[model samples]
Each structure stands twice: as structure tokens, then as C-alpha cells.
Target: MKRIFTGGTILTMAENKQVEAVYVEDNVIKAVGTLAECREAAGSGYQTVDLNGRCMMPGFVDTHTHPMMLGMCRIWADLDYPKVAGIDDLIRVLKEHGKTLPAGEAIRGYAFDQRNFKERRHPTAADLDQVSTDVYVQIMHASGHCNVVNTKLLRAIGVTDETPDPPGGALGRDKDGKPNGQLFDSANDLLSGLDGVQPQNHGPNIHMPDSPDHLMQRFEVGQDFFVRAGITTVNEVQLTKQELNTYLRARDQGKLKMRMEMSFLSNYLDDVIALGFNSTFGDNWLTIGSIKFYSDASLLSGTANVSTGYLDSDRHEGYNYHEPEEMIEILVKAHKNRLHTLTHATGDGAVDPIIDAIEKAQAEDPWPEAIHRVEHAGLVTEEQAIRMGKLGMIPSTQPEFLYLYGDGVVDAIGEEKGREFMPMARFKKYCSLYTISSDAPVTTPNPMEAISTAVTRRTNEGTVLCPEQAITVEDGLKAYTIYAARTLRRSHIAGSIEVGKLADFAILSESPLDLKEDEIQRMRDIKVMETWLDGEKIYEKK
Candidate 1:
């Protein structure tokens, strides 16, 4: 049966087109034009849905996220800035959560940004010990580049004073040189590789796995979380083999609803090459994505390879996860195989080398369509932006970072250098190939909030970080809708509403363009009326 959806303002988001009605058949859009045209297109026996003057547009495509991590966050303790005040508050929350779990089970918490705490320091093992000495405890930083473990967790993971830090990573040390239970970068693998936990070589947030029977429950919760926020597609930025298999298992069981694109860790390059799998390898529900290579840790964690030293410490020039030559070698191999790649380059120092490596790979292999990208592209300078534009480099950025942590960024690097933090407007001037994302588990997946931040350049405290870098609301929306699909190489099938395209859309309570510019942040208050995927309404506001 066909369906004719009318009585709403439909923004096709394709070539800046608008229509009054849309006709959908099966799972694809049949036609989009005026009400009479749509009704004419849809013959008898067709269903009709009156939107009652609502606003409808393409569903959001969050170019970077981790569903498994989001699921883990749902099960774990919430340490987001709003929930905890200081170290004592953190301990109190953990203590209360620990009591509800089975004895000896590890208690995992996530999104704990020390910058938000009154102490202004990461909670040490001693701090976590205040929560529990009998049960193991692990708390991950909001950046997803670091983790903190209690004494019991350290012992459970077999890290001791004698344990040497992993290469290019660090285990926090006490004044007496004893391990202090904070893990950074690759050191996170110590916990991720533990029994019953998901494994990762590139990022943080390790937690116990869900039973096969229970996986769907947690997964549905995560899906609802995304759909409620108006996200229709997600790029699983970094996933280990086990996590990937879990998603595959869910798909086989017919549990997948949202479109999920995947990228493997760089360490898995060997497997990817052996399997002859490049990006975009599967059906719509699940598919291969870029190969993620972390050039450095996140900026807020103070481990990014920044050329300028941190303002707080003259000696703190951030470190890279791989040597220049090593990273280039990996890029060469992947590019030679014609695989798309997204390097996590957050600092000026990190950005240049990764770009150089990609340029070199393209020079040797000559695959212009691969669409190589830089994740974060956090501190790209003017010259680098021009070079990136010439090379057709796509920047997958998280604008919400500026809104949530802009103040800290200004503090890390002085205000002068800080202005370079995610210069979106500059990137648009130099290169038009950029997409915005939530990078959820680091921040909430709210497209409205992201768009608001991008357009206003204002932090949560209403401090304008760099108003010169602001973009228009329309540009911000395209970054999450059309351009985002372009980044994932799926623009043909998804991204917008057009003839023969997938009928995936979000119905809103009001039109964003109709609101005042000052009301951008309040766009978060706009209710999501319904979320439709493949012509089926998956979510509706009660």
C-alpha cells in the first residue's frame, strides 16, 4: 500500500527544494510536490497522514558515534558534568551504584570530565578507593581517550608498580613512582582486554558485555536514545572485532533499526586488507566505513600532538600515538587497498602529518574517490585548510565540543591560538568538504544543540569563544544531513527527501528556519513529533 503524507512544510533538503506533500511507497519516496500532485501520484487504497502543519525534514546523520558505548553508558553510572559536583560527589554516586550490583562485579562509570569537577583534577585510584576497596571500579573520562581505575581494578587488570606503561601511552604514577590507577591512550587496553569486557586498541570506555539474550534490550535502549534525539544514521567511529560481531549478530537476529556505518581500528588493518574489505561493504542497515587511525589523543585530555605548548605547562607539547613514518606506512597500505580512512587529528601538529601521509598515499595510489578524512580536524591552520581543500580532505568535526568545552580549550592554549579551535567558517571558506557530528559518549547526541553551538560559537555558560568562526543555521543543518551522508559515501540512497530516495525523516513541532536566530539553543526544546525510517514510523512522541 502507498502513503501520502501532507499538511506540513517539507524541506526536501535536496538542492534547497521544498514541497507540501510527499508520496511514499514501500520504503522509498515515490514523489514530492504539492498536495494535489502527491494525491494524484498515490492512487486509491493509499493511506494518508495529516501532519497538521508540522515541519518535516531529513533525519539527522550523526557521522561519528558508538552505539555499543552508548549502550554501556546506559548501563553504567552517569558522571556527566550536571550530575556530579566534585570528587566526593563522584564517590557517593559510585558507592550507591556499586551496592545494587552483584558482589565482586566491576562497577563502570563514564563521561567523568575532571575539568567539570571542583577539584579540577582527575579522580585518582585513592579517590575511587573511597568508593570501594572490595569491588573493582573503572571510570572513563568524557574524552574517551583516558580512564581511571580503583586499586582493586588495577589489580584485576594486573597493573602494578612494576608494570611498564605501553608505548606511546602512560599509566599515572604517584609521587613515590607507584601506579596511581589513571590510564591514558593505549593504557586503556589494559582494562578493555580484561575478561568479559569489550576490547579496543584505539579508544577508551571499556565495560562488561551484555549476554546475547540481553544485548537487544540494551541495543534498543541505545536506538531509542538516538531516534528521540532525531538521529537516523550513525557512524560507529571505532569498534573492535567483538563489538562489530555483536552488531552483526543483532542484524542477523533482525534487531537493527537505525542505519549504522562502521569503521575498524587501525590495528585491524591487516584483517581488513586480508578480507579485501574497504569502506561501504554491506547493506543499508550495516556497512563498512572508513578505517580509523588515531594520530593523537583528544585535545581536552592534553595528549594531542599540538605544536604550541599547553598554557598551563611550558613543557606540555602533546604526544602522538604513532611516529610520523609509522602512521604514513599504515596510510599507504590502506590507501593502496583503496580503503577510506579517518585520522583522529586534533592538534595542528597531528593534522599536518596525517594530511601529509594521505597526500603521499594518494600520490602513490592515485585514488581520488576514496574521500580520506580527518576526524576532529580540531586545530587546522589556514594553510593546512587550503592544503586539505586541494586534496579533497573531508573534516568530520564535533561542534558540540566548542559549546561544552570551549572555555577549557581557551585555557589550554592561549586565546590567540584557541581561536583556531574548530574554525568551521574558515574551513567553509577554504574547503567546503566538512561534516558535523556528536561524537556521543563524549557529548550527548543532540543535533539541535550542535547546530546551535556551530551558529553561535557560544559555550554552555554563554561565553562566546570565537564568534568569527560561526556559521549560519542552514549550513549547520546541512553538515548533519546532506554533507554528513556525503562523508559516509551514502548520499545517493539517503541524506535527503527526493524522488526514489529512502523515506527517512524527522517530523518536528516547529520549523527551525521560522525561529529567531537567538532561539537556536532553544531548538532543543522543539519536540520530535515522529521519526520515520524506510517509510515506517519508528518513533512518535506521546
Candidate 2:
């Protein structure tokens, strides 16, 4: 069947190209030109879609996400700001949520940042005990790099006061050296018990398992969050065995509606190698993309390895996830095996070793075309950006972090260094390739919000972090579209609207390009009216 769409701004997102109409045949774009050309391309038995002055562009490609986690978080207690103001509010919210759950069922709360709390402290085991002394209670930090569990859960997990912190992770402790329920990075693995997804220190161990059936349902719920946000393609950046099984199950059961590229955790490198799996290892709908590594801990959690040291007195110099030699060896092995690597390096100190390892990997076993990525690159320096650009590394950034955690970031790193957070303008100048993503469940998957934040550099509190580091709205759109597709190595098929490309488009209420200076700040006001994937309507705003 052939379909023609016209009467609106069709942003091809190809060098800022605009056309009058688009002609689609089944799942592929047949022509993108004037209406007459589209009409000619689509002969008889063609349906016309009147855009009615709305805007049509490529559906967003969020290159970094945790769909399963995002979905699971939907069912958990939301501890995002304005909803839960302080530690007291957090405890109350969790308690209220616990009452609604079946008896003895674990209570989990997500997106809580102690930095935003009126008390300015993490809710300790005792604090969460206020929520539940009987049932297991765990509240994850907004960074997803840590979690604070109640005393009951900590005891259940067998983490005692004498338990030594994991090599790449730490446990928050009280003055007398008692466990305080704050689990950072690999310490979160304790919450997984023995059977859950354990990435060891290779990645943050936060993906606790639920029943397969429930997880499948949660996966659907999570994909909907992206679909409704006009995101048609996502790269699941941390794929453990549990996530792998869940994704496969979702695919086999026909529950997957959006395109996914899974990046296996470095912990699974041996397994992947044994199975002879390399990048782009699966079909279009569910493909294996890269090997994910964590060079450092979470920026928001004040654990990100920064040479300058955090402003926080307790954390001071942040920590690295691996020794430099260990990280290099892993990178080299992956590189030799012809796999793309995406290392989470949120701070300058964390980023340096990653770049060094990449350079070493290429020098020893060259794969010049390999698009190894530096995930976050949140506190990347100008020199580091240039170095990454020289090595053809992709800086996968989340501009929405500025919107969601900008003030907190400033508080942690101080204004001077925090101003360089996500530096889109610097990326443009130094790096040939960079992409914007939501890091959903941490923030939102809303591209418009990210774009707005990228352009305005404004925080949720209305303070602009670094106005000079802001990119134009057009560039922001490209970051989510073409550049993101390139990051996923799916550019040929996914990014823009062109002949022979997949007909994945987002119909918006207005063109983001049309927004003026004052209107740009309100860019998120432009809604995603409808989302089409594989030439079929998948989501529509009611």
C-alpha cells in the first residue's frame, strides 16, 4: 500500500532540508519531494495524510537508554522533586506506596536525589525504616548509580557493618562504621542477592529481577514512555543476562514495538566472545551494538572520578570503576574482537583513561572506523574533547541532565566546572560526532525538553548553566536524529527522511525551527501529536 503525506513542514533533518511531501510504500520512504512528485511516485490506490500545517520530522533516536529499567521504574514509587521535597516526604511517600502493596512485597522508590532534599542528606537505613521495618525497602538515587535500602533489606542481603566495600563501589556508613543503607555502584549488587542481574563492577548493578511475566509487562510500559515521547529507536546501553533474556522474550512474544540496539555489559564480554557475537549482531528490530563499560561512577551521585575533586567534603576526589591497566586490557580485547565500546565516563578524570585505552587499542589493533563512545562525557575538558574527536570517538550526552539535575551538578562540582556540563557547543567545535539522549528513568525521554535545555541551557530552577555552550535548536534536533543514528551505526536506515529510509516519523504540533528566541525556551510546548514507525501509526496524542 502506498501513502502520501503533505500540507505541512516536512523536516527531512538532512542538512536542514525541508520538502512539501513524503511518499511511503509499506515501511520504506519512496520519495521525499514536492506533492506532484510524491503523487507521481504513488500511482493508484494511495492514501493521503494531511498534516494540516503540523510538522513532520524523523522520529527521535535515543542512543542511550535502559528501557526495561525505565519500564520497571514506572511501577515504583516516583521520588522526583516537587513530588517529594525532603527526606520526610520521601519516607512518607514510600510508606504510602508500601501500604498499597501486597504484604511482604518489596517496596522500591526511584529518582530520589538527596541533593534536592531539604535535609540535604541521603535517606539512611534508619530513615527508610520509617517507611517499613518489616518489608524490604530500597530507594534508588536519581543517578541510578546508587540505592539506599532499609535495615530489613540490608540484613536480608547479608550486608553487615563488617562487610567491606566492593572494589569499584562503596557503602555509605555512619560515624561508628555501621552500614547506613547507602549502596553505591557495585554495592548495589548486594540488593540483587544471588540470582538477579549482577554486572559485578563492570556496570552499575541496579537491574534487580522481577518475575518474567511482570517484567515483560513492565517492558511494554517502558517502551510506551519512549513511543509517546516520539522516540522510535533506542540503544539499551547496559545489557546484562537478565535484560538480554527479557529483550529476547519481548521480541519473541511480539511485545517489542520500537527498534532496540542492545549494548552488553563488559561483564558479559567473555560470554559474548565465546558466542562469537560482535556489534550489530542481531536483526533490525533487536540488534547487539556495543560493549558497555563504566570507567567511573555517577556524576549526580558525586562519585564520578573528577581530577578537580567534588565540592562535597565527604566525597572529595571521586573514584574510578577500574584500574587504568584493567580498563585498557578490556578495551583492547573488545577492540581486537571487532566490537564497539561505550564507556560511561562522566568526569574528566574518568574520561582520560578511556581515551587513552581507545588510543592504545587502535594503535595495537587498528579499527579506525570503530565509533567507540564516551558515554556522558559530562565533565569533559576542551583538550579531552579534541583528543576524542581525533580518535573519532562519539560523546553520547544527555542535555536533559541540565534540566533535571543542573542545580545539583553545580552544587557538586561548583559553578565553574558544572558550566561545562554536556557542553554541546564545545562538542560541535571539537568532535565530528556527538549525540543527545535522555538516559530515561534518570530524566525523561522527551526530545523537545532535551532540545529546549540544549538551546536554553536552563535548569528546572530557571538558571542557565552555560549559555555559551548551548547549541542552536536545529543542531539539537540533529543531535537526537541523524547524529544519534550515526552513534548507533543505524544512520543509513534510521535518522532522516529520505528515499529508501525507514518511514519512522514524528508529527509535531509545530516546527522547533519556527520557534523564536522567546519561544525557544518553551520548545517543549510543541507536542508530539503522533508517532509513526515502520510506516504504521504507533502512538497518537489524544
Candidate 3:
């Protein structure tokens, strides 16, 4: 059936910008133009869907996300604070949640940031002991870099004081040299039911394979979260074999409501090459993205490899997951196999190796058309940006950092440096690609809020970190839409509202483009009235 949506300002995102109506037939857009023209083309067989003079645009495409983890957060014990003030409050909440769990079930908690705790430190085994001694309780940090478990868990998992730390991870120790039950990076792999050691060539235990049904359950939860935020498409940043199976099963069961592009981890580069998978391996619904390599740790935990290190009395430079030689080797091999790379390098320290590797890889075998990306690009310098642009590399960045963690960044690395932490202006001037994402579960997946952060560069405290770095509203919108779709190489089918493209759209309460700079911050208040996928109304605000 053909449908005509009228009485609205349609921001097609095409060169023309605005249109009066959009006509859809099945899962593709038929036309976008004046209401009278669209109505005439529709004839009497079409149904009219009134937009009530609201605004409609291309659906948001989140180019980076961890769907499984996001879903797990929904099902697990949420220890995320301001709700739970301190260590005691966290234990109390966990204890209360534990009561609801079935017998013999391991208590799992998520989104626990020690930075927000009054104690201002990681929770140790003793701290968690107050919650439960018998149960093996595990609480993951909000950054997803590490976890703190109880002694019971350590004992149950057979990790002792004598246990050696993994190559890229460390086990926190007490003053007496005993295991403090705090695990960082690869150390958390001990809980993944793997070899209890880091994978041979992998970064950590990111390959937590689960049953297909379990994946479906988790996908259902995460899908709803993204859909509500008006995200019709997502680029799953890191996918293992298990994730591959989960996505396949979900698609087979018709559970995949949004378009997904999966980028397998760099650890599995051998397997990817052996399988002969290329960038265009899958269909539009689920496609191969790029090979993701973890170059360093999280910035929130101060584990990110920064060149100048932390600006404090006791200056300490963070560590990298792999040596420069090792990183170069991985990048070269992946590039040789015709797979694009997406290296996660947040700090200036880690960024060097990644840039070096990419430059070397391109120099050896230049694939200028292949879009190699740098995730986070959090502490990139102007020189690095220039190198990236010259290499035709893209920075897959998250602007929500400004909204949620801007203050923390300022606190760690002085206000002057923090002002340019994620420099949007410099990135534009250097790199041609301007992709932005939520990095959800790290921060919420609200595109409007993400855009607000980009346009304002303001933190939750209302402090504008860098007014000069602030991007325009149009740039923010394009970052989330066209640029994001370009990241996955799906701009032809997705991205903007154009004829002969997928009729994926988001209906907003107001036109963000028509708003003032001050009003752009309030874009979060503009409700997502409806989200459409494949020309079907998947989400409607009540």
C-alpha cells in the first residue's frame, strides 16, 4: 500500500533541504516534494498520515554501540548512581536486589562508577562482602573496561594472591599484597568462562559467546532502548562469533527491528581472513563493518595512554594493550585482507601507535577508498588530525562525552586541555568525515542530547568547556545522519530521505534546524513522536 505523509516540514537531508510531503510504498521512499504533487501522484488509492505541521527527517544512525551489553544493563542489577550515593549505598542496593534473585544465581551488577562514589575509589572484596558472602557478586564499571568482584567470586573462580596478572590487565592488590578483587582490562576475562587467560592474539575477553535465545532476549531489550531514541540503524562496533550467531538468529526470527552493521574484533582477524569475509559480506539489514582493535584502556579509569600523561603531582603515563610493532602488524595484516580498521584510541598516548600503524598500512598498500576509522579520537592533536585526513581516515567520535563526562575530563586533565578533548571544529578542518555517536551504555543513546552536546560543548553542570569547538546544529544533524551512514558505507540506502531509498525516518516535535543556538540545547525537550523502519511505524510516542 502507498502512503502520503503531509502537513509537515520534511527535512529530506537532500541538497534541497525542505519538502512538504513524503510518499512511501512498501519499504522504500517513492517521492518527497510538495503535498499537492505527492497527493496527485498517490491518487485515491493512498492513505494520508497527517504530521500536524511537525518535523520529519531521516532516522538516526548510531555508528557505534554495544547492543548486548546495553541489554544486559537492563536485565542486571543497576548500581548506577546518584541514585546510590556511596559504597554503603551500593551494597545496600545490591543486597536488596539479591533478595529477588533465584537460588544459586550469581548476582551481576552494572554501571557502577567508583568516581561517583563518596569513597572515590574502587570497591574491594571486603566492600562487596557486606552485600553477600555466599554469592559470587560482580559489578562492572560504567566504562566497561573493568570490574570489581567479591572474594567469594575470586575464590570460586580460583584466582588467588599468587595469580599472575594478564598481559594487558592487572589485579588490584591490598597493602598486604593480597588480591583486592579489583580487576582491570584483560583481568576481567577470568569471569568470561574462557581459558581464564587473555585470548592468544585478542585484547581481552570480549568474546563472551552465549546461546541464541539469550542473545535474542538481550537484543529485544536493547532494540527498544534505541528505537525509543529514534535510532533506526546501528553499527555494532565489536562482534565476535557469538554476536554473529545472535544477529543471525534474531534476523531469522524477525527480531531485528533496526538495520545493523557488525565490525568483528581484530583478535579474530585470522578467522575473518580465513572465512574470506569482505566489507560487503552481509545484506543491508546486517553487514560487515570493519575490524575493531583495542589500542588502550578507558579514559574514565585514567588508564588511557595519554602522551603527557595525567597532569598531577605524580604524573603517570598509561599503558597500551599492544606494542607499536604489534599494532602495525595487526593493521597491515587486516588491510592486506581487504578489511578496514577501526582502532579504539582515546588518549594521545595510544593515538600515536594507531596513526603510525594506519599510515604504514596505507603507505604499503594504499586503499584510499577503504574507510579506516579511529574510535573515540578523544585526545587527538591537530597534527594527528591532519595525518588522518591525509590518510583518508575517519574519526568515529562520541559527543555525549561533553554532556555526561565533560566535567570528569576537565577534572582529570585541567580545563584548558579538556576544552579541546574532543575537538569537533579541528576534526572538521582536518578530517573530511564527521561521524558522531552515543557510545550508549557509556552514555544514553539520545541523538538530540548528543547533538546538543556537540553544538553547545556544555556539561551537565551547565559549564561550556569549549565554545570555539562547538559545531553548528546542521553539522550535528549531518554527523548523526549522513556521516554516520557513510561510516557503515550505507549512505545510498539509508541516511537521508530521498527517492528510491529505504523509508526510514524520525518524526520530531520541532525542527532542530529552525531553532536558535540557545534553543538547540533544548532540542532534548523536542520529543520523538514516531520512529519508522522499512516504512513501518515501529515506535510511536503516546
Best by lDDT: 2
Query: Which is superior by TM-score, 1 or 2?
Result: 2
TM-score, every prediction? 0.96, 0.98, 0.96
**Which regions of candidate 2 are displaced past 4 Å?**
none
Candidate 3 wrong stretches, greater than 4 Å:
195-201, 204-211, 311-315
Q: Judged by lDDT relative to the true structure, which candidate is superior, 1 or 3?
A: 3
Off by over 4 Å in 1: 194-217, 313-315
Q: Model 2 over residues 1-542: C-alpha lDDT tens digits?
A: 78999999999988639999999999999998999999998989999999999999999999889988888888899999989989889988998998889998999989998788888777899999888888889988888999999899999899887999998999999989888999999998987868788877887886887888887877888899999999999999998877888888887888788898899899989888889988758777888858999999988888889888888648687788899999988988898898999999988899888889999999988887787999988989999999998999999999999888888888888888988788999999989988999998888789999989999999989898879999998899999999999888888789999999999999999999998898898798889999999999999899
Clashing pairs in 2: none
User: 240, model 3: CA deviation in Å?
Assistant: 1.0
lDDT (C-alpha, whole model) for all candidates: 0.81, 0.89, 0.82
User: Which lDDT tens digits does candidate 3 get at residues 39-153?
Assistant: 8777778888899988999999998898887887778788877877699888988888898999877787888876677876778889998888998898888888878889898
- Ten contiguous residues minimizing lDDT sum, candidate 2: 309-318
Ranking by lDDT: 2, 3, 1
C-alpha-based local distance difference test score of model 1: 0.81
Error of 1 at 481 (Å): 0.7
